[model samples]
Target: MPSSVPPFSELLANTRESAVHFEMRDDYGTNPRLEAWQRGERINWDDRESWWHPFHQTIADAVARGVAVRRARIVSEPVSEYIRWEHYATHANVMAGEDVRWLPRSQATGFLVPANDFWLFDGKLIRVHHFAGDGRHVSDELSTDPGDLKLCVSAFEEVWQRAIPHSEYTI
Candidate 1:
């Protein structure tokens, strides 16, 4: 159970190590590990081409460590492009036994805010809405309430149900 007043980092530390979840159109973070999937060694942050950052690595690492990961997305051309070339399939094989769910983008409907990002983990929820031209400062929505978190989880599950199993997913 997370407290309502503490900053997100505190709540994150108290939760189980593998409980983090995110709803993003592209990846997040500035670590070197992200370079592996992106086309070039350097990422173009502001563009869609750079979307393959830490998100893929994080999920891949989580799966390798035996944490369950579920994903729902609009299945943009980029995701399929990576899948087609077997970029992720290779790492995906290491955690072959665990389940990885993929839901179509259309299924994400209302949840996909063109300029906002969503994250849900344990009982915490964080929503980041981008403002400005280069995505400088962003607005956030944070809550530890079960009801709010459930909405995000439910959205994840709805797409999960309609998604193909990892084994069958293809580019």
Candidate 2:
């Protein structure tokens, strides 16, 4: 852990080559969007403007600057409500020029992977996110430790290799 862990936007802005995110959770507690989706609310897919938020904007900007942004998720199925919502909304990520992929938990058997979610920046530094069992965020760390970096980078690449592209994944 470093003394100063920059915010996600700052990390993204500073990344020169690639940014990869590894998400292994099926739920993230609940947000307004998750709650809405849980109540059967759905995005009006035709109206793309309504869903464009700052995160997607930042990702788009990073892509424009030549940073390759990719996200990989290892989820349990038949998916949780949060994952279902994530799948439904992933088109926004695609539109933002991010490559999104999903790997079922069963598909990743026997692989050594991180316990926390993380964003690996330029393959050197990582920002790891900690969450509680019910899926509420707890804390995060920015690390450059050699062992941590090796595991994060390798695990992510393995997951990315086995993951199904967002466009092709079903449920």
Candidate 3:
């Protein structure tokens, strides 16, 4: 059997005209993979590893190529800890020179949905989905409608305008 998969790539390609999107809730804190990674434990990189994905190459490609990547996070205390444990400690390994835009939930446009939550990326908005709680599962789904992406783009703009710069927030 193949080590990697194709459906995720196909989905991302479908949304190339717009941004990729996802959402999560406090339940994400209970994820085991996340707990281990947060504690600086080693994580296997093989296919059988918990929530593994073969898609980091693509996300890195988008960032390195200077495509505008925007993210609206519902910042909680645990998520904040995860960000520090993951991103700040490995900044050199995570991203090089490209600007990363992260925003607070209130600044973002859409309200948190009752289920998996609402997301519009590259002109598509999806309300219910799941996340692995670690950096392993690449759940980026593509949008079929350009108008959906446009709406997301507009939402990102509204958040981007009111959010603090990463430079200011990163300490």
Point to the candidate with the largest TM-score: 2
lDDT of 1 by residue, 1-171 (tens): 443344444433444534434334433333334346455553344463334434455555555565554433435544643343332533443243235555556555655233344545543544433444443434455665776667666665666667766567665
> What lDDT is reached at residue 145 by model 2?
97
Q: How accurate is candidate 1 locally (lDDT)?
A: 0.47
The collision pairs in model 3 are 18-122, 19-122, 122-149, 123-148, 123-149, 124-148, 124-149
Candidate 3 structure quality by residue, lDDT tens digits, 1-171 = 442333544544444544434333434443564577667776443433343335555555555555444444334443456655444423322342223344555444454223333344345544324456553433534334665545555554555566554556553
User: How much lDDT does each candidate structure score?
Assistant: 0.47, 0.92, 0.45
Which residues of candidate 1, in runs, are more than 4 Å off? 1-12, 17-20, 24-69, 77-99, 107-115, 124-141, 145-147
Predicted structure 3: lDDT: 0.45
Residue range 1-171, candidate 2, lDDT tens digits: 444677789999999999999999998898988788778878886887888899999999999999999999999999987898889989889999999999999999978999899999999999999999999988888889999999998899999999999999999
Task: Estimate TM-scores for all models.
Answer: 0.48, 0.94, 0.51
Shift in Å, residue 127, candidate 3: 7.5
lDDT of 2 at 56: 90
Model 2 C-alpha RMSD vs. true structure (Å) is 2.1
RMSD of each: 8.4, 2.1, 7.1
Which residue pairs overlap in candidate 1's backbone? 73-105, 74-105
Whichever of 2 and 3 has more TM-score, that candidate is 2
